[model samples]
Target: MKKPRNKFFQKNKFDQAMTGYLFLLPALVALLVFLIGPIFYAFYISFFRFSFLEPQNAKFIGFSNYIHLFQDKEFLRALWNTSLYTIVVVPIQTAIALFLALIVNNIRGKTFFRVAYYLPTVTSTVAVSVMFTFIFQPDGILNKFLENFGIHGPNYFNSPTFALPAIMMMAIWSSVGQFMIIYLAGLQDIPEEVYEAAELDGARGFRLLWHVTLPLLKRTTFLNVVMSMIGTFQVFDQAYVISGGNGGPLNSTLTVVLDIFRKGFKTMQMGYASAMAFVLFAIILIFTLIQNYFLGREDK
Candidate 1:
């Protein structure tokens, strides 16, 4: 019975799959020409000591770019900053989002809260960064509020100690809504019967949440973690705008992507920048794989 069914699908599906792929050809070509082509070109360029200004005189330098990348102090610092940002921001954002989702899921006027929370996620990042910059300024509303409590506010963007932390706070606030929506969708999809069973078993309050809701939401949590992790790792726009195009405040807000932009555009070291980008890609890939191992694994 199974062999006959398999033979029938094999006979019918091959032509259908080919036709589907034919329909996808335009998108595939666009992907290749615009995205994949540039990626491979950049990888090829990474082996040469190429510069935007002196492209005609580019020299083949083999693995020197990658070698020097590991030894470069500023690159190391940027790597560290990027890693720290991911570590601090992803978990906080995920937690805040999950909390907000739990609250909003059960509350009256949830529609209002949902719109309010999701507004920031839809807002432009540059605008958000600029707004936060003002908010974090010494004479801004945040500082003025602090002043009422007799607390002197620091120039957050200009202080190495507070610069990265300030960005982290903004990132958490701006991105949490998106993750919360994901959690909300996950919550909505959960079968009502599961809660009924848990209640019948006397699982109430935190116990019900711990034993029922959380276990069911593991996949949602994993999705949030992976996406947020990737976003945090690639953080550049806020750091660039906040730091005035240079990772200033004593290089405290320097991120990997921002540093790559500096090298590629400002310094015209396209080869070195390409190398840094590939390194960043590797870092992201490794972290994602680790997350998959822990969070995305199927239960026995």
Candidate 2:
């Protein structure tokens, strides 16, 4: 009788598993239909030559899209601009966030400062971009302040040399608050006992940070670096709004995503744009993997 009851329980467990899978079927189908299906279809479309204006007339061109991408000077320039932006903004933003986190962690009014810093993160990107645009304008506050010191400020968005850097500066300002919040959370997770013990051993200030704080904040640093890099690489709003959607001056602010938008929508080269999208995706994936690998090795 006991053996029979166990057999019945095993059958019931199998039935419950089947029911759970059945319940998940619709969600799985939705994911495949909407996300996975579109990605694979885009991959297929990238190898061909198609125009959104005449999608029905698409022709198989055998990697001609990618070949054109390689030879396209404008695309190459966008790639270079994006690389420079990521290299500069990612490190600065991460460092600033980490520093802010450290300072806030030791303060008594943690809640007040955290909320104040995080206010920008919850603000609308478009509003912040427009605000920064005005602030960086030739006759705006920043320039006026510089003029008070007997210095002239260049037209930030109007000059080719300064356009990309202007966008980078705005990007850093807009995103740093959120990353600071993340780092703060990481810092709070460090056990109080570790610091207390370190203090007993004569560790203080910069030495405490270098030996104790940063060592334990490895995971947080990795997360912030990867997230910031990805965000900077896909930057669009600041460049688009500041440059008036032309990616100017002289296309100096044209990022990879901006190039993709121009090709996909303005030029109506959907297929070629898909290839650019895939390239950008691959670049992001490679960097993320590199970050994870190093972080994991450190853990081991």
Which one wins on lDDT?
Answer: 1
Q: Please, what are the lDDT tens digits per residue for candidate 2 over residues 48-100?
A: 78886787898999888888888999999999999999999999999999989
lDDT of 1 by residue, 1-300 (tens): 899999999978998999999999999999999999999999999999999788899999999999999899889999999989998999899999999999999999999999999999999999999999889998988999999999999999999999999999999999899999999999999999999999999999999999999999999998999999999999998999999988998899999999999999999999999999999999889988997887645654
Give the candidate number with the greatest TM-score: 2
Candidate 2 all-Cα RMSD: 1.8
Query: How many residue pairs clash in each candidate at the backbone level?
Result: 0, 0
- The superposed Cα distance between candidate 2 and the true structure at residue 19, in angstroms, equals 4.1
Worst 10 residues of 2 by lDDT: 237-246
